[model samples]
Structure formats: structure tokens, C-alpha cells
Target: MIYNLTYNGIIKVSREHLSNKLEVGFNTISTAFKYMEQSKLFILSRNRSGKTNCGYRVILDMQHVNFESILSEVYHLKAYEIAIVKDEFKQPNKYQDLAQNAYISTLNGSNSTLNYNNQI
Candidate 1:
């Protein structure tokens, strides 16, 4: 959802709007936004002055973002570290393979290792 919204570069939208669009509760969206902000995926600013009902301002710098870090930080999934290692190989084309292997390993409750040469 945040990825899709990146096309706008920076967006100002209410938590209620995001909740309605994602079909989730407002508090959930709010918490997710806090996580996202803490993860450095984006900058979140609120209308704290209370003068107006304007929404949050989200500033995204997609170019320098490490999405795997965001996933690990925000979702608290250590398995995404495999994705970070895969990224270190500079093999963007094999990202899907590594991700799938990581998921499969998690599902099978095994700790599969990857070689430095990018082999699973």
C-alpha cells in the first residue's frame, strides 16, 4: 500500500481514509504509520496544532530505501535478513528466488543456508 502511494512522492491523507481504503481499523492504521515512521520508510507529520483537520504529511525517499530493512523492522521478521544478504550479492533478478526460499524454509521450520555465490 505504501509502495503504491509512493507515486505521489508525498501525500497528505487522514488515518481514517487509509483505514477505509485498507478495510482495517483506524488505530491499526495509526500504529502502522508509527512503525513506518520509526523504520525510516517515510517521514510522518501530524497536524498537532489543532487549528485545522488536515491529515498527516508523509514524505518518502524511495530511491535510498532498503525495503528489506523496513520489512524486518516494521514487521519484526528476522527471516527478512536473508533478503538483505541476497541484496548484498547484487543479484536483483534472484530476489524472488531468495524470498521464496526463505518463506519455504520458514514454513518447513528449517534453517536453510545460502552460499555466498547466490545458491540456496
Candidate 2:
């Protein structure tokens, strides 16, 4: 929902607006928005009427990763390159293979290994 709202630019989304769009309860939407706000993923503001309005501001763009469309844009990049970059930035010392193995092992009951000698 945040992704959709912030896709093009900052969007002011109220709790009622999100609840109506997602077909969920008002408290559920508010809680989710609060979680995202606390995580610094979005900025929440209050209007003169004291209603909630959330946005991913231009300066506060840590919410970029929430956009599925952005990920789809990068899907054509080589998998190894993606893994290497993610490992280097997000998980130091862990190669793509090791990361894949660990992730798969968590879900599939099989271990994955890293080819430490290979440079992705």
C-alpha cells in the first residue's frame, strides 16, 4: 500500500483511505502505518482535523525498497551480481551461494554453500 502510494511521488494517505483501498479494518491499517512509521519507512503527519496522513517524502526515501515495481525493474540483472551487491552491502562476508543456501535451508530443509573462491 505504501509502495502504491509512493510510487511516483509523496502521497498523503489517511487511515480511512488505506482501509478502504485495502478492504481492511481501520485499526489494522493504523497499526501497519504506525509500524512503518516507527521503522522510518514512511512519515506520518496529522492534519488540522487530527486525521492521519502518511507519505514517503522525497528526502525520506528509505521506503524505496517497499516498491515491487522497482524490484521488477532490476530482475533482468544477473542473479550473481544482485546477490554479490546485496551481500557486500547488507551481509558482509557472505557470498551469494552461502546466502542462497542459508535462505533455502531455512525453508526447504537443505543446505546451500558459498563458492568463496569465485568472485561474483
Poorest 10 consecutive residues of model 1 by lDDT? 99-108
lDDT of 2 by residue, 57-115 (tens): 22222345543333335234455655553454343332345544442223355756434
State the displacement of the C-alpha of residue 33, model 1, in Å, after optimal TM-score superposition: 0.6
lDDT of each: 0.56, 0.48
Clashing pairs in 2: 101-112
Residue-level lDDT of model 1, residues 1-120, one tens digit each, is 555555544456777777888899988987887766655445456644476666464444334345455446544658756466445445344335654554332335666654343454
